[model samples]
Target: MAQWIRGWGQRGWAAPAGVCLCLFLLLTACGQSAPTGEKCLNCHEGIEEISAAHPMESFACVTCHGGNPQATEAEAAHAGMRGGRNPSDLAVLDAACNCHNGLAETGQDHIHRVRTSLQTTYAGAIAQVAFAFGAQPDPTARYGMLAVTDDNITTATGQPALELFRPGPDDSPMLHRFADNCLFCHVGGEPLAQPYFYRSTGCAACHMVYDNDGLYKGGDPTIDPAEPGHAREHRFTTAIPFTQCNHCHNRGNYSLAQMEFLPRPDLPDDRPLTDLERRELEYYQPIAQFTLCEWKLDCIDCHTNGEVMGDGDIHSSKLEVQYNQCQTCHGTPDALPLLTTIDSVDHPAIRSANLNPNYEVRVGDTVIATTRGETFGWVLWDGQRLWLTKKVDGMVYEVPLALGTACQQKPDEQASQYCHECHAYQRTVAPLP
Candidate 1:
């Protein structure tokens, strides 16, 4: 200022040491400090609550991760580490979400709709293995109703298109047996094992969670190269919990009802087992019946991140990305439609149920919140009955909405699938002897 201290005092430097080196390089380029004193918060200062919405005093761990924040040494500050610690790696999520301008922004681009999800392009298991190998006549082959441009695959009735359906070597042998046995659960695939089934692929396979008892370990530095006491938790969240959507909705044979689990074997080698034989050795064992809001809600408590991340619609199933059912939170006997309109009250579901200290915000009520925020009201009576309460177990309940009585055998007008077809339950039962 003053012509940059008179051109640094005519290049000789000494107008009070070039105005204290131009006020310490303008306060280290306005980020106040750490010009290269190598600060990944000096060994991750309690991981600032895991990217608490991106703030290392304004996104500093080398700006969405590129190494050498001036290299104070973890191998030269992780030497050029671009997306090594999974910056939601779809080959590094367009350069680690180039700060929101490139995840694609329609209803805020959940990693480009989980990178074009149909459970990450299994596209109905590659259109039912290309219609059982006749290379597609029907299994309704849908890459969300295809229209590829280069290498030209086309079909919304302009037919004749297949684009050598995936898994190379000139594809098809049932798409290389559905990409060598049904391509590992998408995103970027591979990475699912216990330790509450670790996940990581684009968007940290549902907003990250990795630990080894540092409980909720955020700022993941990835030490679980096979459990070096598992670390990874820079806590990105959406209040996701349903045990992180049961690590892929409770696995196998299209799980959560086609249900299958085996585990019970290892104890015989020495017979030392007993904590009720290792808690009756792991068994999910079920074949059907599963709703009581899947044991009282938390699949994002009725799936809304614009119905499981994609309001920019490219859905081809998970039942077209499930837009809530059972009358979207139990409302149909007749008149209950007020999902917030009393001045919308700063609606993020009514300001998270008005900061729920056991919610109360009444104004001709119609609440439902939950995903662990828990709100519930629903009231209405005589416009034709409906009743619930549950602001954290204040439990009022009585929403059975009439089925032909006599233990409701079949009239079903979808009142939460007729109260889950006589209320579902089974985690383990059968000891009445």
Candidate 2:
């Protein structure tokens, strides 16, 4: 703490000594740690809470991201930091394990789950590409970008382990092409440093949002606004907008033969784009049959924590873990949706509500849960109808349950592809006016 006070000016803390002394006394009286209250704040004075749950006043920068907060210079201060700057990077995620890393059914296992999820490993993509090129015997995953092991294999599809995918001299050229081109799409690596492709590594890639241009738009005077490839702010959120997901998922296509990523043509920056036009490009391919709910709600609304993050298991394909079906929330003609009340404070669903401020998750409130027992905030029942509270904006929509509606949805065929038979959206783009 003493060394931090001495080194404050090195990071551009050019305030008067009297003001600094007064600030120190105020922080001490208010019961904040001297180092967190003054040192990093000296340069990042106007920075707001990373999130309401993780107030900047409570957490020191070094708590999640290991660094010498007491050091007198940038090089020395950042000497032992995790993942360079982004602690969420899977390569060095253990640094922030105190809060997020776990192997149990506990909500804290997010980091652990994501580390093994198909998103990080790109297991399905790799396995398919290898199989297509005759590099692998079958489409079932034998390798992934990162070598992962699940000691507790609870599911039938779960693999005991996966080796780091390394193609040999005898391997197909397509395998080498996959290794070169498609690997960057996974969360294990930072994304492209271009517009519409800006994001961080690992968990931060989703939780922390980056603008299409990837500039820091927050009030931190120390950060550079002109800098691209940075999250818009130092905030983490569960209420991730669709745009954040679009950074990776909806951006473009890949050519297996050429082993290359073919970015979709950029919307002309020459003119101000329309919302309809932007939504068309941002969410859908040229002719997608998405439902109204799919367009309205943020990606996180339908895709719960369990569906997005793995269940501490390694799997060959996302289809094994991606169990968020259209009928999961909306029940079939045979019955209403299966509902569970928040029975325990320690229930993982509570954390879902706490992280997102869209709705209150309380005991005795009838809410929907996935077939795998994972629940999210909002989308609750009021006897008359089920309500879906949008995550990005607090827009409430009447969840159309198929209990009495004219629907012939079979129990076995509830995947999204089945829903599009009747509920598909066809968006017509009015030529940019």
The global C-alpha lDDT for each of the candidates, from Candidate 1 onward, is 0.46, 0.74
* Candidate 1 segments exceeding 4 Å error: 1-38, 41-52, 57-207, 211-235, 239-288, 292-298, 303-328, 332-338, 342-418, 422-433
lDDT of 2 by residue, 175-281 (tens): 88778787888887668879988999888888898889999999889788998877889898877889998888887789866989998664334456676566654
Per-residue lDDT tens digits of candidate 1, residues 13-98?
11223334544543444344433455666666665444434535545566556788865668888787776866667667666564
Inter-residue clash pairs, candidate 2: none
What's the CA RMSD of model 1 in angstroms?
Answer: 25.7
Candidate 2 wrongly placed segments (more than 4 Å): 1-38, 266-270, 273-277, 408-412, 430-433
lDDT of 1: 0.46
Pairs of colliding residues, candidate 1: 217-233, 218-233, 218-234, 219-233, 219-234
Q: Residue 5 of candidate 2: its Cα lDDT?
A: 16
Cα error, residue 132 of model 1, in Å, equals 57
Cα lDDT of model 2 overall? 0.74
RMSD to the true structure for each prediction, in A, is 25.7, 10.2
Q: What's the C-alpha lDDT at position 267 in model 1?
A: 17
C-alpha TM-scores of all predictions: 0.28, 0.87
Give Cα distance to truth, residue 153, candidate 1, Å. Answer: 63
